[model samples]
Target: MTLLEQLGIKHPFLLAPMAGVSTPELAAEVSNQGGLGSLGLGASTASSAREQILKTQELTDQPFQVNFFCHQPAVLDAQIAQQWIDYLSPQFQKYGATPPEQLNCIYPSFLDNDDFLNVVLETQPKAVSFHFGIPHAHQIQALKAAGILTLVSATNLAEALAIEAAGIDVIIAQGIEAGGHRGIFNETFDSSVRTADLVQLIKKHCQLPIVAAGGIMTGQQAKVLLNLGADALQLGTAFVQCKSSNANIAYRKALFDQPITQITASISGRPARGLINHWHMQIDTPERPQVPAYPYTYDLGKQLHAAAVQHNDHGFGAFWAGSNVAQIRELEAADLINQLVLEMNFA
Candidate 1:
């Protein structure tokens, strides 16, 4: 059977689970249109994640995926975090807000959080996907026992092999062209392979279904990946302009009106692609300090972003996007899905 048949979906499109972007309304619209919609629970608490899942269920009976960050908790150095805050204080001052006295990483680990796991079990989503890394064997066994199909992102052949060996049902082949944080397993972001190359490599090495991602915006691009042996296509930036996305005015306007550039590990200590802005330009200075790791660095980043937003500044926010963001359109989720399906059908 085809991968879509196994997932019980008619279309080969899967919405990328973008934190602060994919809302329940968007997920429902895509699922209701016979495609897989996803809710990103990476930055959310168990209660919020469950609430989003339940809300999506209320809107559609179709199957959808819920994604989590299976990230290990980073050990924060008080000195380093304080240094970051000190460096960012000037930006805060410009906005007339004082930085928090002490910075804290507010994100909890999904691996250790039983509450989040229990909610997943209760919701029994059609698929559960992981970014950053895969779970332990016992955790994988538990999810499989619950009959939840699994998917994970792989940046290289080694990570792809690891996911297949761990018994994940499908692989999301995320290329360097993908926006946001990469899904490399314990590897630096610089090691990520391009999508076109990674998809072809995985097809030769793994039996699991491959879903190509990154830099895919139009029907012609989607057709290129699908024809290259991708069982499905996962798109993030393409859907950012959809009406249901939780993108604020600044973010959506940036997508439509601005040009994006690739930056290497300057903001989040992990390489990410987004629109060029004042924050990135300043951070790129010769005197810029080393960034803290993952969630720890992200905490300080969020504070700066909050301050920026309050002052109507777009420079500090994490406005992530893929290489093909220029092709994005302001359409409703259902209409976008319909157009993609029409393109795929005729291609």
Candidate 2:
């Protein structure tokens, strides 16, 4: 079967697996509308992930994909975590909450996370995907053995080649314009290639089916990529305001009302694009310590964010978004998919 046929999607539109935003309701709605919906399993626990998959199944019999972060094992340095906590003490004080003495990493270990894998093997979802890095060879083989198609996020030609070589079924060519985290595996994210350029380069070097992502908000942008030979389009920010999404009111409003700016390794120690906020501004200070890698840094940030939210402070949260955030509209997921299809058809 062709990529679209194998995934049981009528249109070439796939919902991007957005951490903290895309919910099972949203995924099911898109899948029910004949588009491929995605569940982001990066931040969720095994039980939560299983529940989410079952919920999506209950909502829609149509096919959908589940995504996880195939992250490297976090090396936690107690001293380094303490330094980060100290750095944010002032902010904690401002919120009338004391920062924890020692920070705790709340993220699950992907290397040891068999929960999602076990869920996949048992439930046998139509498809699965990964960001940060590709899964181990045995894991990939096992998923294939279960007839589950796999997808991988690639930020450059080299990464795209690697995913193709790893025998993944499809490549999500994430451009620099993508929201949330950059998915470059080897090279530092500072060297991220733009989406248009990366798509062309990957198309030149690999024969795998490609799904173009990054800053894709409008039907016109989708058309531009389709014209460039992309087999499909994966979108994130476009669906942020979808009624089925789990984005908080503050987050949705921020995306629609504010102008997005590039913040380098402020919230997370990697180049990420999002709405500029008070926490991001703090990272610009010369006195701030270096941010820890991924889940560790992400965990500390979450603690501070929870404290801030308790006091109704929205500025400290990780309100991740893409460059085309302005185009987001408050509509139901099914309605949004209908609009996108109409736009794509008209274009």
Candidate 3:
């Protein structure tokens, strides 16, 4: 069966499962329009993730995918955590707030435990995709036994080969231009390949279906990747402007006003591309210290953002967007999917 047939969708479009921004309404809208919809469950607890999955099931019977983070669990180094906190404490004080005494691991990795795996089996979405790394052997075995397709993000040929070797159903070729997290399994290294090039590179060596992601804002761009052998296209920044998304007013405004984006590891202890803001201009400096581990550093970043928001400083927010955010349009999910289909055909 073709990728579209496996996904149970008419159009070869998939909504990038943006964690904070994806909503049930948006997912349903896209799926209703014959495009595969998605929910980013990496940030949610198992219970909350199940709730969102059930809610989306009620909203539409059409097929959609749920995503989870698969980063290796890291032990927090207190000294390093304290140093990162110390560096950002001045900014906290500027807002008349003190930073947290200690940072907590706000998000859990799928590899950390079977909590997420159990949730996926229970909720049983059409498919499940992972980022940062691939799932464990037992996790993959259970998912396949349940008859759910598994997908994983691949940033380079090595990661693609690893995913193929592990028996993942599809490979999401996440380019360096991808807006959110870099999805490089090893945080220490990233090949930083672009979308079109990565698609062809992986297609040449890997047998899995390739889903092109990153910096795809228009159907013309989507067509380019498809022509280069991408089995499907997944876009995040384009659908962020939809009404059903959870992006705040400030984030939505910034998407248009400041289309320029930069990648920084300071916010989440992982390199993710987003609109240029304080994180890029002020925090990520030449003299900055090495950040703490993945979710540990994210804890402090959230607190500082909350404190800044009380003072109307939205610049501290995690306003993630792809490199092609400048081409974003303000359209509802259904309308945007329809427009992409139209443009894809004409292109």
Candidate 4:
């Protein structure tokens, strides 16, 4: 069956769930329009996840996906975290502020959050997806028992094989051009295999459905991936400029203006693609200090942003986007989906 048939959605596209950018309203509108919408719960607490899920349910009876980060929890290091704070003190001073006295881990990893699992089980969204890594076998079984269709992102064939072996329902074949955190298992990136290549690679070895993601901004691009063996497409940057997204003015402006783009780990201590802003420029140098893992480094980065925003500067914010963000349009979510459908049909 087609993915849309399985999900009972009208379109063959899925909104790439962005943890901070996605909203229940956006997800609802997309799902209501016959494409699957997703709520990213990677950074959310169990309580917030419940609230968001309930809210999305309120907005649409159509199926929507919920996404989580299944990565290992950040290992807190007081010395290194302090060093990070010290390293960014100057930038903090630029906005007349000081970094938090101590960095704190903001979000709990799903691997460690039983409450989140319970929330998922109780809420029972039609689809559940993971990034960074897959959940445990028992967790997977539980989710399946609850009738949730499972998906996980795989950047390379090895990761794709792992996902298939783990009995996942669908594989999100994420390419190097995909924005935000990559779904690589080891967090070490080898950008040689891009989206289309990865999609073909995964299709050759695994029978699981493949959802192609990367710099897919237009319908023609989506058609190419579909022709290359992708069962569906997941678009992140293309939806950021939508009215339902949470992208701020600075991020929207940066997308519209086409700032220098690069992949940097300074913002979140993970290789995420975004506009090259002051934050990236300052920390992407070879001489930059080693950042603490995953979310530990993310803490201070947010603090720096809070300070910068006080002075009307948002270059410190995490304005993540794919390589094709330069072509984003400022349309509503439903309209963008309709246009993409038209483009794909013509292509």
Candidate 5:
């Protein structure tokens, strides 16, 4: 079935989920305008997730996806984690704040999270997506039983094959240039594939429908991937500049004003594509070999970022963006989606 037919939307374009960034208003506005809207539930609690899903449902009857992180629970390295904290001490002192007394795992993988599963079973969004890794059979079955369409990200062909074997409905071919998290199962995987190449690689091995992602910043780029066999396109950075997004002024200005970018593991202890900032520059280096794991290191990163922001410094913020960030424009969510569609000549 066509992506639009399955999702009941006019455009095949999607508002990709961005944790700590995408809001219900942004997702709803895009869905209302005939694009798939999404909420990043990777960092949300079971109760808070339900509230966000319910709120999103209230705004639009269109199908919207709820995304979760299915990564393994972070392994706490007490000594290593402390080293990471100490490394950021100077940055913290610069803003007159100190790191947390201790770092704690802020988020758990959804693979075996009962509360997360129960929330999905109770307030099932039309679709659910997983990142970092695919869930077990039982969880997949539960989501299927709840009538939720399933999607998962694959940075490489190996992950794509696994997603198909696990009975997933769609594969988001997340390329190296994509903003935010890398979604690689192994944090150390050599994932340097581009968006189009990754799409072709997945197509070569899998028949499951593909949603091309990564730094696709324009309709021309989207068209290239769709022509290459992508059923649709999932976009994150493109929506970051929209009026409906939750990006603060600092984040917005940084996306445009800051030109340098990098894939740093320092921000959240995961390799994610974001604009280069003081935090990444000061902390993410060759000498800084390891930090804590995914959600554990985020506690320290956020601490310093929050402290800096309070002192009117924006450089410490996590301003995630794709390499195509230069094309970003200020527009309403619906308007932005509309422009992309018009540029693609689908309007």
Candidate 6:
């Protein structure tokens, strides 16, 4: 069967499940319009994730997917955490605040426990996708038995091979240009493959369907990946501007006014691509110490951002977007999907 057929969607489009930015309305709108809608529940509690899943189901009967972070549970080092806190203390001081002494693990990985797995099985979304790494074997088996499609983001061939070996039904080829967290299974290394190249590489070796993600802001770009052997296209930055998306005023404005993007591990500890701002220009200096770790460094980053916001400095916000954010348009979710279909057909 075709990838779209397996996905139970009419179009070969999937909204990139963007944590913090995804909304039930946005997910439903995409699914209602014939593409796969998605929820980024990596940051949500199982109860909250359930609520979001049920709300999306109420809004649309069409198939949709929900996603969670599959990162290995973060291991915080005291010395490193203290250094990171001390380094950012000055920035906090500028806003008349102080960094917290203990950095909390703000997000729980799907692999850390069975909470997220239970949510997926209970809600039974058409698909469940993961990032940073793959779910445990038992989690994968349970998901497969539940009849929900499984997808995982793979940055390079090794990760792709692992995902395939783990019995994931589909692969999300997250190019280096992707916004948000890079889905490198190993935190310390990234092969840095681009979207088109990654698609070709995976298709040549892996038998599973490929979903091209990252830096895809236009239908022509989506078509290019499709030609390169991607079975479907996933767009995150392209949908962040939708009215239903949870993006704030500052984030929306920056997407249009400042389109340049760069990857930094400063914001969330794990490296993610977002529009260049203070984190890129001021904080990520040559003398910057090694960041503590995922989620822990994110704790400090969030605190500093909160303080900066109080002082009316929105540059500290996490305004994530793909490298091709310059090509972003001002369309709503359904309209954007329609426009993309037209563009893809013509392209």
Q: Of the pair 3 and 6, which is ahead by lDDT?
A: 3
What 10-residue stretch in candidate 4 is worst by lDDT?
184-193
Q: Who is ahead in TM-score, 1 or 4?
A: 4
lDDT, candidates in the order shown: 0.84, 0.82, 0.95, 0.88, 0.86, 0.94
CA RMSD per model (angstroms):
1.5, 1.6, 0.7, 1.3, 1.4, 0.6
lDDT string, candidate 2, 1-347, tens digits: 67799889998889999878878899998999988999988888888888899999999999999998887776777777778878888888888988877655666645565777888888778999998889988889899999999999998787788899999999999988888888867524555777888788888889988899998877778888888878889988888787778989998888878857565565765567788888667666777777767667776677788889999988887788887787777777778778877888788
- Write down the lDDT that model 3 would get: 0.95
**lDDT at residue 228 of model 1 (Cα atoms):** 88
**Model 3, span 96-141: residue lDDT tens:** 9999999899998899989999999998999999999999999999
The residue pairs that clash in candidate 2, if any, are: none
In the range 95-168, model 4's lDDT, one tens digit per residue, is 88977888777877778957888999998899999999999888999998988999999989988899999989
Model 5 TM-score, all chains together: 0.97
Residues 72-97 of candidate 6: C-alpha lDDT, one tens digit per residue: 88778899899988888899989999
Model 6: lDDT to the true structure:
0.94
- After superposition, candidate 5 runs with Cα above 4 Å error: none
Residue 119 lDDT (model 6): 87
Segments of candidate 2 deviating more than 4 angstroms: none
**Model 4: runs farther than 4 Å from truth?**
189-192
Report the C-alpha lDDT of model 5 over 1-347, residue by residue, as the tens digit.
Answer: 77678777899898889988989998899899999999998899888899999999999999899999988876688898888887778788887887787888888789756788888889878888989999989999988887889999999999999999999999999988899989899987747799899999999999999999988777888888988889999999988988778899888888788756788888888888899887576776677857788888888888787888788888878889988888877778887887888777751
Q: What's the candidate order when arranged by decreasing lDDT?
A: 3, 6, 4, 5, 1, 2
Model 1: per-residue Cα lDDT over 227-305, one tens digit each: 8889999988988888788988888889988857565565665567787777678876778776777777777778888
lDDT of 4 at 93: 88
